[model samples]
Target: MSEEELNARHAEKMKKKKAARDKILATKTIEKGLLIVHTGKGKGKSTAAFGLVFRALGNGLKVGVVQFVKGKWETGERKILEHFPEQVTMTAMGDGFTWETQDRQRDIEAAKAAWERAKAMIMDEEHQMVLLDEMNIVLRYDYLDIADVIEFLKTKPADKHVIVTGRNAKDELIELADLVTEMEMVKHPFRAGVKAQKGIEF
Candidate 1:
């Protein structure tokens, strides 16, 4: 074919592709949000959870965040959430980190309290989104009651959306969710003996 004819054919293909994409986009549903669970041993579960919080905030949704096993240590997400006190309701369990907990019973109590707090926030019809940060781990560790948690979540208003983030989420929780995302660790800076960087992996 001549060069001009080839260019014309390319332009035609592009136009057809664009038109097809536009048609598909128009039919897409405005999602009613979801009951989402993020689980796996990957490093970014917490970050991914908060990323959704920021998205909800941008869309003018009220969000509730309850961190189950980590508090008293400064992290980028906490600082950002702190700035949006009105839009975001965050309650840290004050357990710091599981490994740092000197008393197991105390740790469990702290986590249980946070779980209860999260349940109440999620049950409230006014709360649009609930980010149960690391609550899955608490459930896995038996620090919180899975049955109670599930009941509370299931009873929430239909328009409410919940996001659970942690490593090792139970199969029951996964089954309960409308959407599930597993973040597998293919590679991580920590594996290379490098410390976690601020903002990116804090």
Candidate 2:
């Protein structure tokens, strides 16, 4: 086809696409807080959750974060979030990963403590968004009662958003969540013997 004909065809296709998208969007009028889950074995689960936290902060929304794991490590996100003391309430409650700690009981205790803090943030009216970092990992290990967690989350305020991030999310939690993202690992540097560098993994 001629260049002019090709350009005209593309413009016609795009016009139709925009009209269809606008029609579909018109049906989505209801606005409410969301229960979002980021799960799977991929590397960016927690990273994606932090991105949302940053977006919420940019919008002047108060955020509360409960780190269920990696509490011992000093992460770049944590350092930057700490600077926003007035808008962010963050608690790193985990001792470390279960394998590193090598104590099932200690891990359970730490998970419980973190869950308590998470519940408080979910219940608090001031916090518009709450991030439960590595929550699925604890849930996978059965460190906390899944039933109780689901029930508590069900009762969260209508206008409060909750984001949970970790691998192997439970079926029950996935069913209850309004949005669920499973990150599929296509390739990873860790598998190729590349150590996690600062500002990328942390």
Candidate 3:
């Protein structure tokens, strides 16, 4: 085909694509709070949730974060979010991972304490977005009852957004979420003998 013919054909395809995209966009008119879930074996679940925290802050919204695990280590995101005290409320409640703590009862107690803070944040009308960081891990270990969590989520304000992140998310939670993203593991640096790097992993 001639170059002129190729250009014309490309333009026609793009025009059709644009029209289809616009039509789909027009159909999405519902606006309400979203229950977003990020779960899978792959990384970036909590990272993705934190990205939304920045988005909420940028939009002048207040956010509440309850870290159910990884409470011993200091993360870069936590340091940054702490600077925005007026917009962000963070509570790191876990002592550490279950294996590290080596006490089932201790883990359960920690989880219960964290859930109280999370519920408080959820009930607070001032927070526009709430992040339950690594909540799936606790749920997987049965630290808290899934049914109770779902009931609490259902009671949240209509305009409040909630994000739950961790691996092995429960099926019940996924069913209730408005948006669910499962990060499939394609490849990881740990397999290649790379330790968790600063800023990137922590």
Report clashes for each candidate as comma-separated counts.
Answer: 0, 0, 0
Clashes of 2: 0
**Alpha-carbon RMSD of each model:** 2.6, 1.3, 1.4
Residue pairs in clash, model 2: none
Candidate 2 lDDT, 1-202, residue by residue in tens:
9999999999999999999999999999988999999998887888889999999998899999898887544478878787778999988765687778898888899889889989999998899999999899899899999999999999999989999999999999999999999999999988889987877766
* Residue 10 lDDT (model 2): 100
Q: Rank the candidates by lDDT, best first.
A: 3, 2, 1
Instruction: Sort by TM-score, best first.
Output: 2, 3, 1
Each model's TM-score? 0.85, 0.95, 0.94
lDDT of 3 by residue, 1-202 (tens): 9999999999999999999999999999988989999999987898899999988898899999999986534468878887788999888875687888899998899999999999998888889999999999999999999999999898888888999999999999999999999998899999999987787787
Runs in model 3 deviating more than 4 A are 71-74
Report how far off residue 120 is in candidate 1 (Å): 1.1
lDDT of each: 0.82, 0.90, 0.90
Least accurate stretch of 10 residues (summed lDDT) in model 1? 69-78
lDDT string for model 1 (1-202, tens) is 9999999999999999999999999998677658899988877677777888999888888999887867544477777777777898878897575788778888888887887798788778778999888888788888877887787777777788889998899988998899898899898777679875666666
> Model 3 scores what on Cα lDDT?
0.90
Best by TM-score: 2
